[model samples]
Target: MSNEQKQYLKKLKNTKIKILFWQILLIIIFIFLWELLVNIGVISSFIFSSPSRIFKTIIELINNNNFFIHIFITLKEVLIAFILGISLGFLIAIILYQFKLFARIIDPYLTMLNSLPKVALGPLIIIVCGANSKSIILMALLINLIVSIITIYNGFLTTPSYQLKLFKSLNASKLQILTHLVIPNSYQTIIASFKLCVAQTLVGVIMGEFLVSKQGIGYLIVYGKQVFNLNYVMTGIILLALISYLLYKLIVILEKKLLKHI
Candidate 1:
C-alpha cells in the first residue's frame, strides 16, 4: 500500500486505542466512586451493593453455571425478538411506501401502539403464548416493531427526489429504483434505527421476563430482590449494561461499513 494509506491506518489505530483506554478509565473512576460511597456509609449497602460485592456475586453465579444459563436465555429472547421485529418492520415499511394512502390511514394507530407500554400487555401475551419464552419475545417485538417501521418508512420516504426522478427518467422499474436508490440512501438511517431498536428490544424483553417468566436475567434480578440479594441484582444489571454496550459497538462497526461508499 501507499505511504499515505499506511499513515491513515496508523492514525485510525491510535484513535481506537485512545478511545478504549478512556472508556476503561471512566469505568474505573465510576467503580472507585461507588466503592468510596459504600465505604463512607453514604450509600446503604443493603439497597446498593458495592462493586466488589457484585463481583463476588458474579463469581459465585459463574461457579454454579447459573450465570451462563440466564445470560443465554435473555440473549436468545432479545435476538429472536430483534430479528422478527426488524424483518416485519421493514416489510411493512415497504408495503406502506408502496401505498401512501394506507400509511396515512394507519399512522395514528401506529403512534398509539408505540406509545403503549409493552409491560401492560404482558398478561395478554402470557395468556396467548402460554407464559413461556415466546411471551417475552412477542412482547419485545410488539414494543420495537412500530418504532422500526416508522424510522425505516421515513427513511424510504425521504430518499432524494432528484435520485428518484433520475431513475424514473431512466425508465427504471420500482424494484430497480428501490434496490439502487432507496436502500443506499436509507442505509445510515436504517443502521441508527437498528441500534436504537436493539436497546429497546433488550429493555422490552427484560421487562417481559420480569413480569411473566421464571428464567432469564430479569428473573434473576427479581429473585435477588425477593431474597434481598442486592449483589446479584447489581451483577445482573452490570451484565445487561455490558451486553448492550457490546451490541452498540457492533452497530458502530456496521455503520462504518455501510457509510464507506457514501
Candidate 2:
C-alpha cells in the first residue's frame, strides 16, 4: 500500500534473483573447468572423472534401464525414513517435555547414542534385519530419529517463560497450554527440524544402501568402485547432490508456506 514498502519488496526480489543467477553461474563454471582440466591432462579422467564422462555414464545407466530404478529406490527409502524419523521424534519429544524426571534420566543416554557413529551398528543391523531394504530403512531411521528428537525437544523447551507463567495463572490444563501455546510457538523450529530430518534421512539411506542394497545410488557408487569405474561413482555423487539440493528447496518452499502466517 506504501511506496517505500513496495520498493523494499522489489529490492528483496532482485537480490534473490541475483543470488540464483550466481549460484547457477558457479555450477556452470565448475563443470566447464572440470571438463577443461580433464581434457588438458591436468587430472586423470580415470580417477577424477570429467563432467562429460559422468554424463556418458548417466546415459549408459539409462540405456541399461537402471537409472530410474536406482533413483526411485533411493528416494523411497529417504521418504520413508524421513517421515518415520520426524513422527517418532515429535512423539518422543512430547513425552519428554511432559515428563521432566524421565527427560533428565535419559538425557545422558540420548547424548551418548547421538555421538556414537551409526555406521558401527551396520553389521549388527544387517544381522538382525537381514541383508535387505529393512536393514536400510532401519539404519536410516536410527540415524535421523535421534537428531529429530533433540532438535525438536530443544525447540519445545524454548517456549517463553512469561507465556508459561501466564498460562499457569489462567488455570489452563497442561494439554491446553501445550496445544494453544508451546507447540504453536515452535512452528519455525518444527519446520527447521524438517529440513534437518530430510538431510539426515538422505545420509542414512545412502549409508544403509551402501551396506545392504542391490539397487539405489549408494549401491551404484559401491558397484562403480568395485568395477574401477570412477565415472559411475562421480555420476552417483552428482545425482545425490542434485537430489539433496532439490529436497532442500522443497523444504524451503514448505517453510515459506507454513510460516507465512508467522
Candidate 3:
C-alpha cells in the first residue's frame, strides 16, 4: 500500500484503541462511584445495589446454571422474532414498492402504528398466545415489523431514479433490477434498520416477559423486584447490556463482511 494509505490505517487503529480504552475507563469510574455511594450510605444497598454486589449475584446465578437458561430463552425469543419480523418486513416492502398506490394508502397508518406503544399490547398478546414464548415472539414481531417495513420500504423507494431508468432501458427484468441495483443500493439502510429493530425487539421481548412469562431475564427482573433483591435486578440489567452490546458488535462485523466488496 501507499504511505498515505498505511498512515490512514494506523490512525484508524489508534482511534479505535482510544475509544475502547475510554469506554473501559468510564465503566470503571462508574463502578467506583457506585461502590462509594454504597459505602457512604448515600444510596441504600437494598434499593440501589453496588456493582460488586451485582457481580456477586451474577456469579452466583451463573454457578447455579440459571443465568444461561434465562439468557438462552430470551435470546431464542429475540432471534425468532427478529428473523420473522425482518423477513416479513422485507417482503411487505417489496410488495409495496411494486404497488405505489398501496404504499401511499398505507403510509399514514404505518406511521401511526409505529408510533403506538408496543408495551401496551403485551397483555393482549399474552392472552391470545397463552403466556408462552410465542407471546414474547409475537410481541417483538409486532413492534419490529412496522419499523423494519418503513425503513426498508424507504430504502427501496430511494433507489436512484437514474439506476431504475437505466435498468428499464436495458430491458432488465424486475428481479434482475432488484438483485443488481435495488438491494445493493439499499444495503446500508437495511443493515441500519436491522440494528434498530434489534433494540426494539429486545424491548418488546422484555415487556412481554415482564407481563406474562415465568422465565427469561425480564421475569428475573420482576421476581427480583418482588423480593426486594436489587442485586438481582442490577445483575439482570448488566446481563442485558452485555447481550445487547454483543449483538451490536456482531451486526458491525456482519456489515463489514457483507459490504466489503461493495
**TM-score of every prediction relative to native:** 0.92, 0.95, 0.93
69-148: candidate 3 lDDT, tens digit per residue: 99999999999999998899999998998899999998899999999998887778877889688998899999999999
**Clash number by candidate, in order:** 0, 0, 0
Worst 10 residues of 2 by lDDT: 51-60
Question: How far does residue 261 in candidate 3 sit from its true spot (Å)?
Answer: 4.0
Q: Candidate 1, residues 1-262: lDDT per residue as tens digits?
A: 9999999999999999999999999999999999999999999988899998998888898999898999999999999999998889889998998899999999999999989876888888889898789889998999899999999999999998888999999999999988889877898878988997999899899998887778789999999988988887888899899999998899999889879988
Q: Please list the C-alpha lDDT of all candidates, in the order they appear.
A: 0.90, 0.95, 0.90
> Total clashes, candidate 3?
0
Select the stronger candidate by TM-score from 2 and 3.
Answer: 2
Candidate 2, TM-score vs. the true structure? 0.95
**Model 1 misplacement above 4 A:** 1-20
Q: Assess the local accuracy of residue 50 in candidate 2 as a C-alpha lDDT between 0 and 100.
A: 96
Give the C-alpha miss distance for residue 233 in model 3, angstroms. 1.0
